[model samples]
Target: MSEPARDDASRGYRDHPRSKPGPGSITRRLRRHRPHYLTAAAVAFALVVAGVSAGVQSGAPVDSAAAAATPSGTAAASPLTAVPASPAPAASGAGRAASPKATPPPATAAAPKAGKVPAAVAPAAAHKPAKVPAAAARKPAAVPAAAAVAAPAISPELDGQIGAIIAANSAYALGVSLIDLSDGVVHGYGVQGNFVAASTAKILAASAYYHLVETGRASLAAPMGGTTAGDQIRQMVQQSNNNSWALILSAVGYWGIAAYAASIGITYDCTVNLLTPEEMARTLELLYAGRLLSARHTAQLLSYMQNTNFETLIPPAVPPGIEVFHKYGLLYGNLHDASILVKGSRAFVFVVYTRGLSESDMGPRTRIIQKLTRTVTGALF
Candidate 1:
């Protein structure tokens, strides 16, 4: 059965008859938008009331009851009459407030009256009774201890020293990298441009040649004359002699250096003699970690290389008792750059390479390199 469509006018006053609407016009619009407006108004009013009574830091309405609590649970003697003035509500707009029938305040609300004024809002009564005195002044909130600890900042004094040392050592492209090896902490200029690797390349050559010797394909003890070839390699590393390098290179063939370098995790251009600072640093780290070879092999390798009589530059920068496995290469084309292989718990790898300088210009720069290296290692260790 069909029924007549009811008129909006027939509905109660809530459906404002004067504004009766067509299906697609006012009625539809009000149906969709009225709830949204009501929700927005409610949120806005709540914000205004909250703002009116809020503490500056907390934005929480003043918790007079919480503030009123004392060690004792008894009601206080007086409920103090404070000025009725309140902080302004949110600047957005005045919110609708509940209107109530006016009535006299209860005796509990009666309080000390000041110079003539209307009814004032009484402060909350304290919990403790008159028998016990109240706190001197309301105690400030109990401060919570900070959860996170701030690590000591890197001191400016340290930075200044590094700068001074860098300025002094103009000969070698000297630099430092501070790292937490286990946590992969990186400090200073770690992944930057290449630094000249002077005799450090020999470290790679030594590794390859020795690996061959250990396998019996190449023999370190094989005598070239009255002297053994292995003994000659030992002398060359300890002395930084050219003849020893030429001998080892010949034995470790042209392809052998590249092959062995890759195996040891040195991926830079092992074809030629040049390598970046990062490559050299990584090589030293791998060796220190004992990943380059077995422990026995690694210890022997470090022993043969640590003879520092010829690695004259960096040795002077360190304390006399400290141990360092390092090498220095002097080529006519450029200034000398020393590669230092530091071992032990505070393991570090340092490279100081100098370029565009002759013997005259190199003195200050090389000295600077040594001073900075000494300072950095000492500070870290």
Candidate 2:
């Protein structure tokens, strides 16, 4: 027949004993189970082939160093992205390859640490912003030079004269803010204290109008209080008319004045129109500096002030020929005068505020102001 049924010893098949089932009887059983064994063998062969394929895939070589360099699969990758528990043998070997090429720049830059090359490098290093310790370190050398400049000195004799004058007038509280525009020497005894603004508030109203006019927010030809802006300003400043001041204040509003005062660092009392003598002087300074108004508008305002009706104090005391641009305030017992006095080419801002003295005796108060004015003028001029 077909070379009796063969059995391989290597696989899980074995020969049966002759008594239990002789080769012939086993042969018949084998024939009956042959198909089933074939099916089982086919399944086992397929499983063995799949296992070999899986082993081949899992055992493939891995480039650990390249993986470390680009864990996210990007071309340009960071080696510092992660650290392993132990150094990878491959990466350590790769890092050694880069060390020689990467080490020179920092080494040369760090030569100062050795203390031998410091003097040569310190000058160049001092100019570098990267090594600067703080923001203040980067300031220009000229800044401190400019800040170290000493302010011009005020004389002791001038101080004594002003002190003596104030000491002599013990009846009234006097505040003065005087500054020589030529040299920027500020000499004042009680310049910081506040006094009633009175008609001086009209100056601010006029200034506000001019400020608005210059900014194109308002026009000089515009009808304010049924009258033109020019007429109102002249009436308010020259005549010190309350009605013109009321109209200007209504047009500019109280907060407008407060804004102007704050811009110049002057403390303002919105309720009573109270301000400091220094503030008044500074306002005049701004006018003189061409900061608050155009030269044309400033000249216009100064003209009004020069011709102001109240002239009992500064004008009478100043040299007759010298032009005095001034504004005066009188409220209850308080008398205030602020002027930008021009003698020839020289000019100065002088402000005086007097309170706690009765205005009932007009002659004495006026004479006292004139005396104080003359004393200051003589000392300063």
Candidate 3:
């Protein structure tokens, strides 16, 4: 044994440090501790398996607990939390087949605070309507009923009567207009026909002078045509005095008269002095309605008109109780009468224009006008 121990050192050689144990020694030691090593390895493997199984079981329970804690109405946590989806609608027999899985209820929103606007919510599935056909969708809606229209002012029966009257007296060129003050209805035949205005246009000059007086540009008492302005107007209107009319025309230029006529809605041509029955009626209507002059001036002018020097055409035919304020014009072939007939709470304006008449003799045309006045009064009143 002593010799063996010193053998390597004595020989000038060194043993390798990494040299393996001898085979017999290794085998014998392995044999002796083999059972213990195997037992320990088996025990370690079983412990690792048990740890993994316990981790899996515990994860399941934790997930189940979390699921149970959540409310039934709420959706599961997800990346998209703002816009919750609406519930699917129930299936109908006529529609597509029903899905196998049940539809989840919509998520409940948090209650809004006082004065705070609630968040927009998806509409309920039941409230949605079924799909309609393209044809049905494009159909137009029914139109509503229209309102009633107003009736015409001139009745057919009255119009026929006037037509008969006009036909009976077709010999002369006649234009007539009648205005019913009660309803403000105007009906006429040949109302637009033009004729020589004649002295009936004296009202225009008188109106122009009154307009100036009203605006403080002139005075009623101021002298004109060797008489006061008031007296001159009275003479021109009541007596149809050409001298007074000429004086007034000169005082108020043609432009002034035109401007005054335009102010009252009349297009007056001073050179031609042409007028229609409707124009004369409108002028009288304005005066009657107190639209032309002040109350005092209107009363004064109307007074002058009532007892005019010439009342042979309209005033003579009017009934006694009703007062007539009228103006008549007679020139070579043109003859006209414009009148305002008034009673208590009743008034009317009647105008008639005629041509092909003799200035010296107006009896036949005058009788026709009287008959027309009677016919209108009989028909209307």
Please, what are the lDDT tens digits per residue for candidate 3 over residues 244-315?
988888778889999999997789988899887777877876666556776567667776776778878887
Per residue, candidate 1 scores C-alpha lDDT tens digits across 1-381 of 235778766685375687776668977788999999999999999998877757465754454563466323333323322222232211111111111211222223211122212122111111112232357335543532231222212233444566566555443554444332332222343223554555667777777777887777887778744587777677667776667777887888887777787775555454457765555655655554455554455555566655556655676777754455666666543444334333332344555555545556556655665776677666645
Best by lDDT: 3
Where's the lowest-lDDT run of ten residues in candidate 3?
90-99
- Quote model 1's TM-score: 0.53
Model 2 stretches astray by more than 4 angstroms? 1-154
RMSD of each: 25.7, 28.8, 34.9
Query: Which pairs of residues have clashing backbones in candidate 2?
Result: none
Worst 10 residues of 1 by lDDT: 90-99
Model 2, range 136-247, lDDT digits (tens) per residue? 5677655423343333222455555665666677677777766655444345664356778778767777998888888888888989778897899999999998888888
Error of 2 at 198 (Å): 1.3
User: Can you give the TM-score per candidate against the true fold?
Assistant: 0.53, 0.58, 0.58
Model 2: lDDT of residue 130: 34
| Candidate scoring better on TM-score of 1 and 2 | 2
